[model samples]
Target: MELSSLKFYNVIVLGFAFMLMFTGFQTCGMVEQTVLKSYRNDSIVNGTVTYNGDGYTSLAIIYVVFAFANWLAPSVVSVLGNKFSMVAGGITYTLYLSSFIKPITATLYIGSVLIGFGAADKQRIPLYIGLTSVCALGTALLLILRSHPIQKLEVGDPEEDQPSEEEEETSDEAAMLNDSLDVTHRLSWKLFLTRDMMILSITFFYTGLELTFFSGVYSTCVGATERFGEDSDKLVGLTGIMIGVGEILGGALFGIFGKKTIRYGRDPIVLMGGAIHMVTFLLIFLNIPDLAPLNKTPDSAYITPNTYLAVACGFLLGFADACFNTQCYSIIGTSYPDNSAPAFALFKFEQSLAAAIGFAYSSHLVLKWQLLILVIFAVAGVVAFFVVERKVRSRAEPSGSSYRNI
Candidate 1:
């Protein structure tokens, strides 16, 4: 359908924005975890490195900084506005990416910290810079567009005459009181203890953990296995590409068909994703070799990754990831519209904490055990999803309100 036929701002512009932002940030992320981290860690593992101690330390720093940065993001966004906040974040990302070009221990650590700081906001800085840089030319195209959306305050418009000193003072006091209430009421232990929060927290933690597996562990596995012989680095990068493709497709599919499946509730979608992930983990456990140094002999054949299977697993993991993540966001937004800011902030905080923990221990875990752990978590996440959905339905039924799809 034409852009005019659809809701341009909500459907088209927002979709394009998400795609652009995703491509910029996710591409950098995929490369960082899969290709760059592999190269860094492989060197350390082989005893050929002096700087960048095992890469996990750097990741830990990034996530740790990110966890605390979430608290500051809202204030930053309020001050900078969405466009400038994105631009600011992009600058940090560019700095982080540039450090990789001449990665020393100092630069790597600094870059990681910068990325973490930028990531506290909705869009990390470096990715936004890349996305916006590319889309600069598209601004000319926007000049020809005619749509303009305006937001008006719900309260009646202000009078032309200035307010008296007493009225102004009262208004200022009221505004301060409202702001205090907004901050205090936005977050609460009661809300945090809700079923939806529990499910979202568990699933988001998995999201961070799975990301670590892909970026740190999985890439290392491919490299150590000598999956592409002399070209394993290239292959690892390619695997990341497959996963990115899968994520894009999965996101698009959900965007298109999510409403149709809403009648069945979010748990089914989450379960489907978890099932896909479990299968992928099983295949990985069975097929992919460990990250340990291999001893190949003339009599012994090299156990390389099956090209088809590797690609398939990557795609499926990414797709399943999208299912869990998007649905979590949808649930939080719809369930607690008033409390969404802190709810999502807490979500990001937990995600960063999990990622930090996962990355800190990633280098120590065996491939099989890692996969097994993921499978278990996936199962648990599905069960949690079901519980949340049922609780929501029960609550809604008592209120004579029907649960709606994301």
Candidate 2:
């Protein structure tokens, strides 16, 4: 007997993703830094650039697009064919990968529109909030649904025969009632009510905020500090080095300790990852200099051990990001089999919405409070940790059907 079609598809989807995601993910680290550095001189507040309704017209636009993406992801999947959706998303990402956004008025606006429009083609995001968000959203949408050509079919035994429409209706209705899902209501909306997914979703909001700060404030630290120099782009590029190193370490750790992590499943891993995330963030926040000149000075002495520590912490942060994501996905897949696609979709939504809000919030906070914003953001990370354990972990379970079941 041959391998099942479902198994084949799974291999193709995940295998291709595992292979290509690196190129996409590694590219993103640098792109994010560049975008953040673009606003170096234009930072309205501290090192942040909160997009108010007017001041951040471009960020504002992108925020709306992301929100729209959240709303559309679940609802719009069937409307676009998988191939078309993939093509659209590819085109859109290519634009971002090539052009991205800048501090300037013109390019940023164009980039936002392109990114938003391209991102809207498909739905559902992935385990993490970064590259996963980019590819997962579209991949989930396509993966969730299936339709085989008539020729692929073979006759089945009587016991395995298809159920009658009445039986299906009754089953669907009963399932809906049992899950408290209203059959008449929008399917996607109800899908959002998964408690465990919500926990991750809430944390994503914090993730977005953290990333916004990371991109902008990280550059800020390097920029105003005497060490990195005026070329913020080059300083920001250091993120790639740290992320690359961390990814290599993460792979090695996964290779050595894979079974141990899986034996406990993702909860402990998520918890540990969350702790690492919170601590690294705290370390980064604590290190930010309170008083610094806006312009460069001859003494430029910020590149002390603190900068090296920050770099090391950055590597840990990236590792934490990867670990939490991988574990979370494994958990969702095992726990909520039926709702896995929806789970991931909601995950992306939270990340996107959070980033949109976080960018604006951090911008404002950094301007008014400086290090205080990063400090509180670190607190938010802690809160995010508890929220997952208390609110999400308890509820994650063997509910929802796999796409095949549906």
Candidate 3:
């Protein structure tokens, strides 16, 4: 009955609901490139090409549209309010999943666009129907969630000053309008020109770039390597599962030790994540054939493709990715608590744009070149993050206190 307890319960329920939905959604994303690519290759071989699309193209479209959707999400959320906005968003997923049943290229592309909307945030029974059913359940749960509690001032409390109901309603409406205007202003050129935003954008962009790789491209490379044997297709799913495991582990650790980690600040965690990613990239370069990114390849890299290595890399990639994301969320929230909507919108915009570009080139670039690009961005991103963090800390320091290096 207590507000805090009710809030915690809501969060827990929401977490579980999302877990169920994303379990299906993320699994599909992980395997989509491989599955679609295989279908295309097979069709070509058989001369029966009904669908001419590949997963890379589909993912590229999703992220590019997702980038644009970020600009519209705030207005959509403001108009619909948070809860209904989520339900509306959830329905998009169901529609996306439904498109998979017959798998027409047009439908798939349309579904990709719809899902991109959902994701900036669908299904089929056929095997996809099961995924759709799971997601629908999650949406159902969202529909039932209690809206967040509104706190009322108690008489005799220091902040107990209260206004008449009509006055309060007018004030609240004014505040809402002002907040919306503030978000819009911040999302404009002013925020983009800030030194902090510019620097942080690099890290944000890299996160998206790296995100596309592990979530989509890496699995495709794994599936395409013939050296891994006919079971390479199976390995794609397994690699995805391992990545999910690592992500869960990292999330659990960060959630548990979050307060403690704050003592040392976010940069250390980000640096550690970047280091892990660099190592993972090195291993991929050594372990996967260069041609793996373009198509199914009959060759091996310097090291023969070992199932264990692929799985381990996936785990490391996922774990490191969690580190970057969690830290980025913290940094943005702390830096722009007053204007978090625009800040987050900018973050998603940059991230999605980078992801779109990465996926666009996924089919064209070799594994080595992709790895090199990741490394270059990783280094630049880390440096930029450090610079912005220092500036933020400097600003946060008390007027008379010595600035302690993080």
Candidate 4:
């Protein structure tokens, strides 16, 4: 919030930190594909029957838990503050990851918890500012939990910020009156319900779906490949490597060029990202078809979308997706152009909720119908593209006066 913190070098440092920090967690950004990894490992340890049924349902449950957890994160953070939330995330992550080395049932349950904890990590990414903001907070919270006991942060008395018991009733009455008085709000609900936010939400949702597919589902499938006569943990590891690389490249590209494109405005980058995402989804989805036996030949089976191709898709999306996400956040947080908590809160809420919806839908669809989930992602991509052009930019009426609506 300080002017000095917004300096160019500070911006660069902050951006750099975000990338480095993410490199460690390697955020499952479309990491659902990695489900293939755990599935493979579990099959090896516990045998093949684990892979026989709708194991994909487990992935779906993981996602649903993550979405629900993340949806509640902001409200939790509001009560607990960034400091406590970070601590909680770290503890949850450690517990989740710890389950991996344990018994079969423990691993799945632990991973699910970790996924939910990780969702909070996603929600809090945009709120904190300064150097290495995301990682610093993530590390601080998680590390403290691992290293030390859960002594609560002395975040001042909650009552300090709240109305007294007597005043609470009066405040509630005032809120009721305010609600009754405003039938048609002076501002367009459209401003509050602007197309840009909706567009960003849709695009980000697809991003979430792609992420979950890799991190959650693909790993499961890859792990279970032996059921279909292909067993390669090395292949699964390579998949993990691909995801890490994609996220770093994607984030770095965004940090480097996102601002430069901001002057011409954020719309171009968003649309370009959407188009690329559509192609990427098609490419990945095409892999499934290519895997079909009919597509195979004696000398060399028809190759599915390569890991490199998927990684490249993620990298490009990072570059393009950053513009829309960043612009949308800035618009909501600063639209009022003043110290209005509601303005920023609305923006933060949107980001968290969209992520939740995206994760949930992606998980559910992938379970209900496997590769077909890509079509849903495609539809979201198109929606983002259409919303930006048809609903958003086209509907705007130019005004001579520039008024801050915060």
Candidate 5:
């Protein structure tokens, strides 16, 4: 196969690897609030204490640690190399899943911490129980699959200032043998403080905020609405499926049309995502009760609880999420192609921090208030993204000829 074909093939394989792992982890995460809240407070199982309503706090802890861990991740990955890094990350996830069997506060919290280090997401319990096997298979696949080959950049002379293939392999081996902590820290922080990065951080934070809302808060609210009747828990899972379907469709649409969209830049897509999210928020504000996030509510704010509408909102939420996330990946990949790892680390740090904050407030705030916050961030984020996009484009254009051409 051609090198370009191999490169594309590697990208596809990597994406599927992540999907296999996240499918199980996130499916379980979707219903964590409902399941954990059901545990009787002060109850003992196998002589371990059970605390009710700890799910929000647990999710919060994961993102909190994940935020901090992002800084160290580059160093760790550099030291371990791509293959071993995957192995180590997979192990952390496995350990986290193992903790679920015993169901103790210590195990749960500790598991959260471990998985946070590994960068994990979660779901509903019986589903998690079944999905654990799927996650394990994904982990094993990482071990079985070959590491992706790095494609050299085309800019400048291919031979000039570039190491030979053997030298590159040797350098990679040396990096794995040496500590990269100091270099990783310096590059990550330096890039993070740049004007472009600082502005883009707003969009990153907004992405995380909406992620928490759709993944955890919204699912919980859906389950808590008494108007959904006794099968509300089931509805949460159904909502998750709808969200997944939307995400898949959105991803497919963009992925296929990406070549055509490349000339337009990301601002339009970001604005469209922001608009979709605003609409979703509006639907939530009208259809879901104010107190839905906190507990079961008998009625919605204005409209009667329509299960179809609720699931439809989930679909919209997921579709918008795809737009933002794909743009984020594109932006980071293009803007800092030479320093992509650090750029990604910085993005993850900001995004996870916002997710942590959102989870922290999820249990306290009403659904309407949460929706309001999302709206504010959505507007701010879209505007910030547009500004940065223009700045980047201007920098790419020939400064003197820009006016002459126009």
Candidate 6:
């Protein structure tokens, strides 16, 4: 649909909200991961034997909490609704970020715990409180507009009067009641054990695993090399920026062309992303141009062609990530419209669990082996997805519809 279409106003608002909120969260997360490594090397935190590793360990432990919290998210969303759930998530995020304001080890751990709760709800607090405040304001504005007299927009129709405050309150109460009922039903194994869920879960596992590698280990790999020397940390941070750039481009591309891709089913887009991701992994596995440290001056260290190649790989990784993630979300939403709450909760659960595992082992794995493992998972996820799509199409063809009844 056209961006200006009034029918898509809610979509527009939600899209902006996602962008504004995620930008802050992702940037802060990148900094946190990068600094975790940097701090370990420099002993930046007081009263900590190893600040760097402890930082990551803290996050990993929290992710374990997050996996369990996924089951609680629907209830939270049901009660607070998306807007208020986000607001509550934002508050938790604010608390976590504030912990960093003082740079104490204890505070950092506390912040990690608080953020874990936010992450369970898939909310990332903005680094700047002002940004979170703006989101809250925007949400409030939307709520007001939803209830405002001008919402009717029927210029000369006397038949329809603006809803009264009591009427509005009643409407909201009814919605909340319905949502609560929906949440109470709970997900069944029968509904959760389908081929589609299996395929999606595997891919989501890879998503979690891949993200940890990038955010947790990729920078360390670059920085640990003898060539980047002390400048490794800085370059690692730069690579994070490149990944973000690719993610923006990838998300925009998918947003613009997703409708066309949907006609072919979600598999094509997902496979395309997986293929791109594999190529990037292969580059890392081969160690193209050799990223080993060369003991060069800090200013000259990052000027090499190999460094740029790593940055380029980061971009492709983000781009491919966007493609995979967007298609998965679209498919799940469309396939299980009625049961989407549980479907997404399971999705997040799988992703968070896989991420926790990845983080726990990242410090110990060899780079080539890690890439090898990811590549294998990537192929498996794609194969499973392809099989699921084929079955879905075959069933749909006999029924004379584009999608099967899940």
User: Least accurate stretch of 10 residues (summed lDDT) in model 4?
Assistant: 292-301
- Residue pairs in collision within model 1: 89-125, 90-125, 93-126
Give candidate 4's error at residue 228 in angstroms.
Answer: 14
- Give lDDT tens digits, candidate 2, residues 92-190: 544443333223445556766665620110110221244545544444444443445323326664454344755776557545543532332345466
Worst lDDT run of 10 residues, candidate 2, spans 118-127
* Total backbone clashes of candidate 5, pairs 3 or more residues apart or in separate chains: 8
User: How far off is residue 356 in model 5, in Å?
Assistant: 1.0
Best by lDDT: 3
Candidate 1 lDDT, 142-220, residue by residue in tens: 3333344333234576744444755776568656755754674456455667757876677778877887776555655
Lowest lDDT 10-residue stretch of candidate 6: 117-126
How many angstroms is residue 56 displaced in model 1 relative to the true structure, after the best TM-score fit?
A: 3.1
TM-score of each: 0.76, 0.60, 0.87, 0.56, 0.83, 0.74
Question: Which scores better on lDDT, 2 or 4?
Answer: 2
Please provide, for model 4 over 121-203, each residue's C-alpha lDDT reduced to its tens digit, 9 standing for 90 to 100.
Answer: 23222322221344455445333222222333367755444336547765576566455324223232334576565554555
Superior candidate under TM-score, 2 versus 5? 5
Model 6 error, position 155 (Å): 12
Alpha carbon lDDT at 388, candidate 2 = 55
Each prediction's Cα lDDT score? Answer: 0.64, 0.49, 0.80, 0.44, 0.78, 0.63
Please give, for residues 122-193, the per-residue lDDT of candidate 3 as tens digits.
212255677778888887788766765456666678965456865878568756876876657566557778
Better-scoring candidate (TM-score), 1 or 3: 3
The lowest-lDDT stretch of 10 consecutive residues in candidate 3 is: 117-126
lDDT per residue, candidate 6, 249-308, as tens digits? Answer: 888877666766567677888889999989888776554222221111222222443667
Q: Model 5: residues >4 Å from true position, as ranges? A: 1-16, 41-50, 78-81, 117-125, 147-181, 399-406
